[model samples]
Target: SIHLLYTLNIFEFSNTWSLTYFRPTVPTDLWDAIREVELSWAFPGHWLPSKDPVKTVYFSAGRQQWIETCGAVTRMKGLQSFTLHLSGSWFCEPVEKIPVFLEPLRDLHLRQRWQLNLPKQPYYVKEIRNIDGDLRKRGIECSIRAV
Candidate 1:
């Protein structure tokens, strides 16, 4: 069903497709390395914590950590058969406004939790302020805001 989903993305299925994950929430590298991906855009059956909602994926890693995980997935060097993840607006604003020029990203899964004085490093970030950043080909500036 990867073709279907990929085509769906190329076509116009974002509005129709539900923001849910029904397989492993792995990274693109892992998925591509695996070579086989099961696209079951359905909600998972397993239970979870965190009142903050989340779609399922293959890696089981948080969406916030996707880029990092994708870059360094030690054992994630193969095609994947399934993926599950949640997609939505979280802390940092999404890159959807612009175009997707990065790796093969099917969708975005995230959650925004507005907490102040956390142990996070940033050039400048307030508890209830909007996060901002610039994305160049080499890197990107990111921030979070409680909209």
Candidate 2:
């Protein structure tokens, strides 16, 4: 099973393949040190191997910080399900940005520290609309709760 941990600034995988996809709002020295360690230990082999499949993906982000990047993961060929751990604050993106192909997602778990706000009707009524609308549309069963 392959586990990919996506933090605010760091994107790490269980196979030791990791990268700093985006610059995080943190100290330069700290980021550099962490990056150095990750690079040194990262496996210099093919990512997303066919023989050894990726079982799960773990993602942590600050509110809507990494919406675009997270959504991109849906494009992966063999990704079936994923777990999203939210931190910092609650956030939501437009329905268009949400992945449409969620049939392959068998187990969707969302663990959040703060409140989660999804898009709502009337354009503005709730702080977070939650993912019921999006997930329901795709017939995806998800378990969402606060951590």
The numbered model that scores best in lDDT is 2
Clashing pairs in 2: 117-128, 118-128, 118-129, 118-130
Residues 36-112 of candidate 2 have per-residue lDDT tens digits of 11111221112112343332122222212233333433333333333444322122323333333233343333331
RMSD, candidate 1, Å: 13.6
Error of 1 at 130 (Å): 28
Task: For each candidate in the order shown, give its overall lDDT on alpha carbons.
Answer: 0.29, 0.32
* Count of backbone clashes, every candidate in sequence: 32, 4
lDDT tens readout by residue for model 1, 1-147: 554453233111121122223124644633334433222211222222234445344224433343443233223334222232223322243333322322323222112221112123232235323222232232332223322
Q: Which residue runs of candidate 2 sit more than 4 Å off their true CA positions? A: 1-67, 91-141
RMSD, candidate 2, Å = 15.5
Looking at candidate 2, what is the lDDT of residue 24?
Answer: 43
Clashes of 2: 4
Estimate TM-scores for all models. Answer: 0.20, 0.27
